[model samples]
Target: MPKRFQSVEARKLIQVSLKTNDLREARLLTGKMRADLHSEWEGRLNGSASPAAYPPDHLDMTLEATEAAYSRIRPKLENLAKQQELDNQQAYDAYLRKLRNTRDDFLRAKACKPLSVWSDLADRRISKNNWILPQGSEGYDTFVDMIAEAAIEAFNIEIARREGQFAAEPSSLVVKAGLKAKDDTAKDGETILDLFDRYAAQRLAEGRKREDGITQDRKVIDSFAKFVGPRKSIKGLTPADIRDWRDTLAALPPTYQKAKAYEGLSMRQAAAKAKAIGAKTISPVTVNKHLSTLSPFLGWCVTNAYADRNPCDGLFFGIVKGKNPRPPFSKGQLEKIFASSLFTGFLREGQEHKPGIQRADDWRYWIPIVCLFTGARVGEIAQLRIEDIQLDDGIPFLLIRHDESTGQRTKSGASRVCPIHSELKRIGFLSFVERQRSRANGKATCQLFPELEPNERGHIGAKPSRFWRDYLKRIGVKSGNDGLGAHSFRHTMADALRTAGYLDDEIEVALGHNQKTVTAGYGRVRQGTVKRINTMLEAITHSYISFSK
Candidate 1:
């Protein structure tokens, strides 16, 4: 016995038979027994096995806790309400309101005679393997309110039964507690996958989440379910289960999910294969992203009564400080990039670096320049329409927006206008727009860069991003996995804005980022705001690169 368990159990010695004659088999059985005993002893020490030592007010407001609390005192409350024999529906309604007030007062003051009754019930439940709410926690208050609400609902159902309004068996209060109703069960029962599907459907119906995001979330959830067990009930999930999954993901290759050799293999198998081949595992940031998806899903499960608590909470890999994964292009690298064959002279559109007389005025020639100036995403630049370019109050700016009908979408899901830089106009960008508009022949839906097309994932930047990578390598500006790409331009722009003494909010507005501060959301963007941003955009200047050819 270990020293930690000496005081845990009063017994000086505990014994269990291995029931094996073979030495190796006996050792394996003994190991399993030791693990089980350790788990049980730890649970006892943590108050999970005996509620007398349970900490107060720490349990989150989960459906299991709320339901347990409600079930404890519901029958007594119902009998009290029936004994009152309220004469009319108005009196019953008033009684319901009174119960609601008591609940609210208990939450605010954390004291009342009614709370004493609940506290007693909580003590009884502690011995019955149920969780107790810790006082002074938000979960404690929410738990009290939910139980009070359930009591009132029970009274209402009793009133209906007395008045002959309901004939069948009384419905469970779990539905009112935000759990799925008994009758709402799916065909084979609600698995983890079913809950995730419900979550995805609700988010998609609300239009707040994008399909691409949903797809990524689904992949993570699916992998987790498979890692644990495909048919495992969500209610059985524990923090240890989530921790094991996180550790496994950190060990596997970054491309294990999509790599051909790793396909159709279990997570552990793929991890072992990766270890054998000396393949690098996933970074902390990527592992954290997986946890981010699971955290919200588990939170939703708690709300919907699929789980007791979010097991994914606080389970994340620690990222190194001050080590940026993606770095901006250096000044020398930027100079080399703009002075390359694509910017100066190229053979033709496809063979830009081969050195020919053809001046490429297509997407190949314009998107990079536009991204460098606007700090806009490559996808945003690729999906622009001819009508997106307009003169507002005599100032030329590009309207970066989302239009579902036109297959154009912004990362933030909202729209912002970016003022065209003066250098672009000096280099005949407006003339290029005129030529595109003339080619459109009055078609409002015509794309600004008509040659660029969306890929299978509906992202127009896919091809352009690939081209930029190849171009950077061909121009000797970057090498494999050095993190320099089209997105580097946005980082460069942000650095330039910060260097010019612009505030983060102003730069965020210029780059179409969703503002984080409450004050930034107070005002609507009017013409004055646009002009102010335009003035801020004018501050970006590159002294090394000249507009003149």
Candidate 2:
């Protein structure tokens, strides 16, 4: 009987032949040998034991000499381990990308039927990667578990080869990297969800004066969390995971669904239901928005040391410039909009539906019109107060500023004055304001459009946008699946300005865009500048062919 023990740290073997032949005696000898070997190993581990002795002729080739050699090579070994970790990450990302590309090609080649119908095809494709168990099949969970184990085993083997020491457990490595294990919380760092909440709260705190992006960031982070998995470790979130999430986003349905059938379902469930019903997919720009929002949060994670890297750093969805999802309205479309029942006669006072322009100063009536001339965002126009309308030396303009008093939201330096164009004055806008002010009887009403109110989400434009969409449908306008909704009017204004030979700066100023220049940081745009802007805006003229007429 032979008793054998290998020392990983020493890169040496201990072998002894037991003189006894009986099974009981052999077992006793094995236990004794293991205890002696472990005692030696413990001494070596604590740097207290002498190296293995060698023959006089081989004095330089002993275990002590080898340990000295290893000491000289330790830094190289550490570098190799780091490089191996990087290589593993790269390999995993490449494999995931290949899988995704294969799946996409397969779906394109065959008709996209139900999951069950393509089960065999998926199995066949997955087998090419040598996944022992099939995807979407029995013991698939086991397959996933085995793959993770295999990866860890490979990593451990590499560590042992390089360092001449057996690697620690995979869970320990993950914990050391500041990521949680599946069954255990990480001792080093916080969970992704916790970090996300803190990140969101921090943003909210920073933007206490204006919180336009706070809700949007929360929504996008929620989507990212859901896509990756609720309990996934932030430190474990790889580039492969981000790629998978992006692929999932490509297949997802539009956020704004026409049907209300899947209202109460989760985003995942709703997406599945939407696909089942053949609902439209979201645009590349929207997918990019999802990426953009998530990237900053991951960057924040990196800053806080919760994550080593931002997985979404350079990844982007390619957008075709001419294939704009949200195209501006044509002149004909604008005419139809102004000639709609809401503007003509169907709108009535106090009643939701009546025979004449009911709420004359309503946001629903004015926002689209305001968007056409000023190219302002719907939220900005929707949340306007009476005080925002300012008159400077007989010239009237709208001061689109972020006012905490009125709960108006705007991005940093999204404050600019847009001169009220000639078309708005022609449409009785100033007259309507005067009437409302007269009715207020010296007490100023806070809101410009008193009929409009904020929704539960605290977005002033939400309800009005819904109502506008329904109105678009009622007026026989095909609001394209691409973001060409009521907001297209803003695009239309930009196009109109560009068509009229307006400079890019002029257009940016009109839209209250945060100018990225030293001069822009100087002071408020002068009243003279507003007058010039109104001249550029005056070029936006559409001859209405009224349905009422």
Candidate 3:
């Protein structure tokens, strides 16, 4: 009787209601109303009463199941309508209202439209102060969905920040002692696989965004593989077992301490190999990073109940001192490294991809010059694509970034435009990059120096071990603190800035380090102090290397 029932949905309700002489309408309407009230009652979705889109083939079947069940109760509704005919308009009105609510409930759950809205709504809620995600509640569904859709999963990362307090669920101790499994099935066992899986999965899930997480998992797996003797469980892992592994590794020098851990294995090996070449001690920072990668894996085993304790905990070995790290080469040493043609091993008589001439370095024998000139990190150089270099600018410059391997980012986590050294233009550095661009099949990002492949080490591009060692000797570098190492170029530039009257803080920023100088006390790099250092460095270099505006 209401004018609202005249629409297509209303007409269909009347027809379906009359299909079995109104026999099924009463029961069908009542069932739908009950379901509507129970599910998504709080979700306030108001739109034209229409069936929303359901998931493909799978949801198609669920929709049909609900519809089929509705048909079975058609006759009951028809009988109720006839019996209650005296109150026809009032009873029909109530049934129609119930039908709308029931249909709306089915539409929402079956379609998952509410999920998208909830995702948006939940993110807004998380922005509130101290809003921790609900672990396993209906509210958690939205958070989980956001992680699934986002490229970087931040869910598990929230757990890792509370590292110190994290303990076996019921215990308060940080020290790992004998622990029993919380699960009934594993009540007799000494370890908990379920907790281990939960922690590892969280670490693995967050691995995409956090590089540290990947290394953590890797350490856990490697340690587990060692302790299990192949593929056993924590029941077999013991303190003595870990000690033996440590003793074996200790017998060998910590070879990986200087390895180019970030650029991959070949560079890392070259770092260890450089020591024999008379380079000073490989950096402990490098060693520390590798240990960092290894340490968390050890921690996860105990924390997750995979093992009773960390074998690496308080495990101390002789770490090389800080003074041993490569110091900056002086002005005279830098010039010699750049000018010496004898440094290149070049190609031998029988090499497969031999060069016609003996030009051993990339960047026209001046790549090191530009890098030292700019004080740009190796990774920043490695990430430079053809487009990233504005070679056409009358005043050429580089767009530096903290871009990880993904290439979507820049360093410092911000895009910084740095002016190219005037010397770069006069020395034809940009031209060499242009030549590398034309001759190569791929982009400049594929490889910076044509002489070096992606994995080659020691210098800009050359990888031959004997060649690398011999070149260092040819450069007149002192073996034990007399000459400089590969990183000396970077250090050399920092020294150059200091000599020109720039503060230590300025030098730190020019070098692109993201750390506080607490240990050093006085020297710190901050603000745009790096650029000011660069201006001073530009003044210092012109005394030896000439370039025009």
Winner by TM-score:
1
Q: Between prediction 1 and prediction 2, which has the larger lDDT?
A: 1
The parts of candidate 2 lying over 4 Å away from their true place are 1-185, 205-212, 226-231, 249-285, 313-316, 347-361, 524-528, 543-549
Between candidates 2 and 3, the one scoring higher on lDDT is 2
- The reply for model 3, stretches above 4 Å from the true place, is 1-224, 227-239, 253-291, 301-309, 318-321, 342-364, 391-394, 404-415, 437-453, 456-470, 474-484, 515-536, 542-549
> Per lDDT, what order, best first?
1, 2, 3
- TM-score result, candidate 1: 0.63
lDDT of 3 by residue, 1-549 (tens): 234433323233322341223323344344544455333322323442333432223222222222222222334444554665435667666755554554455355435644344354444434432344454555456343332222111111212222333331312111011111111113222223333334444554454224344434455455435433343345444556555544433332345433453234333344444445655443444444544554565577677656666655565456765663657766566555554553233454333123344553354344456667777654455455666676332556676654545443433455555567767666677776677678676465645544544332113233432333345664455474343444556677777777788877766666665546565345442345334533655676645643321
Q: How many residue pairs clash in model 1?
A: 6
Model 2 CA lDDT for position 434: 76
Q: Flag clash pairs in model 2.
A: 345-355, 347-356, 347-358, 348-358
Candidate 1 minimal-lDDT segment of 10 residues: 178-187
Prediction 2 TM-score vs. true: 0.59
How accurate locally is residue 263 in candidate 3, as Cα lDDT from 0 to 100?
35
RMSD of each: 21.5, 22.4, 22.8
- Tens-place lDDT per residue, model 2, 267-303, is 5676677688887777677788889888988899899
